[model samples]
Target: MSRTKSERYFFLDDADREAVQAKGRAHNRLGLVVHLTSLRYPGRFIPDPRQVPTEIVAYLAE
Candidate 1:
């Protein structure tokens, strides 16, 4: 995933913060968002989020 797509799909806005926070763990939070967004864009879970682009992860982390 690119930074652009990550921002467009995986970017967790304030509205998503509460739900993501409820996940209660760093990996879970990221994984949830990644899984959700993946279903929207590339239309699949990408198998392993760790393989996600560094730029995408960095942008979503913001």
Candidate 2:
């Protein structure tokens, strides 16, 4: 039997979540999320939001 891929969970805790929310505006929020997720994952910081993955951008947008 083939093994399935693992699920990735991007859960931001209360204090951290508030800090992220405090960044101000959708533009700034997206930027900070990109910076944070880049370090959490195996990728580098994306310079453009248009270039960031749809999955990542959607998750952060929530």
Identify the candidate with maximal lDDT. Answer: 1
| lDDT by residue (tens digit), candidate 1, 1-62 | 55566677776667778888888689778778777767877788889777777776666666
Instruction: Write candidate 2's Cα lDDT for 1-62 as tens digits.
Output: 11111114344567767888888888887778677766665566656657766666666677
* Model 1 whole-model lDDT (C-alpha atoms): 0.74
Q: lDDT for every model? A: 0.74, 0.63
Per-residue lDDT value at 33 in model 2? 68
Q: What is the TM-score of candidate 1?
A: 0.69
Candidate 2 off by > 4 Å: 1-9, 47-49
TM-score of each: 0.69, 0.64
Find the candidate with the highest TM-score and give its number. Answer: 1
